[model samples]
Target: MSAFPQPAQPSLFGDDGPLRDTREPVLMSLNPVYYDLIWAGEKTYEFRRRFLTGQSVRWYVYLTGPVGRLGAVIDLGPAVVDAPEQIAEIAERTRAGNGASVFEYVRDLDQAFAIPIQRVAEYPGMPLEQLRTELGGFHPPQGYTRLRNHPDLLSICEKVRADSVRREMTVPGH
Candidate 1:
């Protein structure tokens, strides 16, 4: 038998049908510097070689250690795919100062894409241990994955989304 227990079925739907879940799972192996920059709203775009094409994917940040946990949900704009120089131009137009970093990350690659992101909600995050317990054996994705495909992770993300909504509703201004 497996050492870790499987997750229960996700209660992701209402009587009508599946709830519209816009959030997508993304495991970013980010350094603290980049993480802080993204959180601070200093960085507006995330560089990547590939992203889910022709899809509206809002990234759920799973910040790698030394702060291993689920951090925030960011709605991503369309992936702007082009050659390195072209991508840099787009970044400059968007006023993203991290354009140079994008070039660096895509140095060897002929083409790359940048996903513009705005933080929808930020949280302290679920620790790795807790994540492992919930997911039955969580390993950070080397690249990224769609959370909807992973029942266990999707369930946790759904809770996170619910909590975020609840917190917003309880707030005085919201």
Candidate 2:
């Protein structure tokens, strides 16, 4: 009776390619300003001081403050770890007006991560209050929390991802 396809049913991407099982998803808190950029497809890379390298990941975006909701999921490519200047170069090459800010953010660190945004899926989000009520007390992560560590949250994300895939499949020319 459920509208969304079950996870174990079949390949959402098609028969030849099953969904690539990336590393466990992470819940990341984002400032509303930057979250808007990401949602609008203006921001191509997410700069991080520390993050898992060598693996792709799905980031469950928790928009902080005025927008206190888990609003979107972003699929990210493997992180590009490099010197601050080098990372800044990537920002400049990809999107204009972000290079200086990116440089400033990573300047103090020896190395930084430039996580490429592969895809983004927006959905009707679970608000913070509702999440806390459902989870019996939830705090948005300051750094990041692996979804696997919280089965409840992981289950929610899985459903959302499945629905997103279904929508993509139904969309013409997807």
For model 1, which pairs clash? Answer: none
lDDT of 1 by residue, 29-132 (tens): 55567666664556667778877765556677677778887756667666778899888776666555656866777878878887767445666567789988
Q: For every model shown, what is its TM-score relative to the native structure? A: 0.73, 0.78
What's model 1's TM-score? 0.73
- Which pairs clash in the backbone of model 2? none
Q: Where does candidate 1 stray beyond 4 Å?
A: 1-29, 92-97, 165-174
Per-residue C-alpha lDDT of model 2 across residues 1-174, encoded as one tens digit per residue: 799987675566654435556455999999989866765657778888889889888898888999898767887888999999999998887779789999998899999999888777777778899888878888988888888888998876666555533111111111
* Residue 172 miss distance in model 1 (angstroms): 23
Top TM-score prediction, candidate number: 2
**lDDT accuracy of residue 18 in candidate 2:** 56
Question: In angstroms, how far off is 1's CA in candidate 1?
Answer: 60
- Clash number for every model? 0, 0
lDDT (C-alpha, whole model) for all candidates = 0.66, 0.79
> How well does model 2 score by local distance difference test?
0.79
Model 2 TM-score relative to the real fold: 0.78
